[model samples]
Target: MPRVRALSGPKPRDAPEPSHPMPRHLRTLTALLRRAETVTLLAVLCVAGGLWAFAALAAEMLEGDLHVFDETLLMALRRAGDPARPIGGPHLEIVMRDITALGGITVLTLVTISAMVYLVLRRQRASALFLAVAVLGGQVLSRIAKAGFARPRPDLVPHGVDVTSASFPSGHSMMAAVTYLTLAVMLARQEPAWPIRAFFVVVAALLAISVGLSRVYLGVHWPSDVLAGWALGAAWALLVWLVARWMGRRGGIEPDRARPE
Candidate 1:
């Protein structure tokens, strides 16, 4: 019996363990990316809807249907006897002129160039290029819109400033929105604080609004023109931002790294 001990079977090697689950950080990043994508999509849809609504209004205006509305608004900004005098008096006219310049080609171009140079100096080449393209493309688009609509500047009131361009969509208003919003987004991305980001966005919006209103007050653009500009410009800026964000996530552009507390 002692010599009859059975030989022990060789031990089976431990089965290779299943691959580890994805890292927690990676999972978090994936979830954040999905959320960002959803938000971007929703924003784009809303922008498109706004642009469509504004475009419809512009079309009505071009058909001479919004004449009364546009004339009423333009006339209201002037004195009863004098179309030359805006409601806010001489000093206010000066102020409005100054504000309107913020959206002018020269001013906006300088701002864009300055921002681009700053980004380049920061080594944000992609961001600089993104900004340049957004602004230049906006300029081109504004020109095309003007040519396509071929609407005339308002004759209901006297002009506060000299303007010579088609007026279905105010180039000043649209460019203001495109430039300010794009710049604001670029600046805000550098900061991590929500309040700071909101401030940048709010300021940009206010500037765009003021510029559009100036055009109306000056009687160079109809209300619908400004509205259309705001809509289209906003849509363009948002579209550009979404593209940049997607590219950054894919490592095609520089990431906006989280700021240290």
Candidate 2:
């Protein structure tokens, strides 16, 4: 008989030894990581909407398009005969001042420092550094916006609080949103439970809202200013959160249980 040609051609050279012999578990991890990154990118894109809102508001304000709206809201909060008198009487003013103090520089600084210290002691050094950068960068942005706009304070009503800064965006509202929201997001990442995470974010949002409202009630910030501050601050907070998530994915910081390494 003629020499029989090998039926299988040397077993197809051992099936070419599979170029990437990744383990099942490793492959699963890779898929999960890609999903996580996709989520982070989507979140950042959504946050851009908030920044766009702020830009729109600023543009409107500059064109005097919002003057009537701002004046209406500001005046509505005051007595018809006397613009100096806020609707809630003296006692309410005192309460508002106290609430406003919660967003004051002293309180925010203390809170930030305490939180950073706690994170540092827990050996989450990267997170602590991130917190500082978030807050300080926000402050810088606030200052630049104030100087750039040089918007005058509301002359229509007597300010309920001693005021000094340019009034295009409320510093109290913006800073409060930045500090509290950033802290809440970082803390939420450590907890795996959905309700707990929701609680953190919701409470942070309430605090920011209250601070912004107080600025308007106190006859200091124009309603539009408060709205702009909220928009910008929220965008900044979300940006910081996205940075944390991105960093965690790269193993540059302590990985979160939420990310599932």
Q: lDDT of all the models against the reference?
A: 0.86, 0.87
Best by TM-score: 1
**Candidate 2, superposed: residue stretches over 4 Å from native:** 1-38, 259-261
lDDT (Cα, tens digit) per residue for candidate 1, span 164-183: 88997889999999999988
- True-structure lDDT of candidate 1: 0.86
**Predictions: Cα RMSD each:** 6.0, 5.0
Model 1 regions lying over 4 Å from their true place: 1-31, 258-261
Worst 10 residues of 1 by lDDT: 252-261
The weakest ten consecutive residues by lDDT in model 2 span 7-16
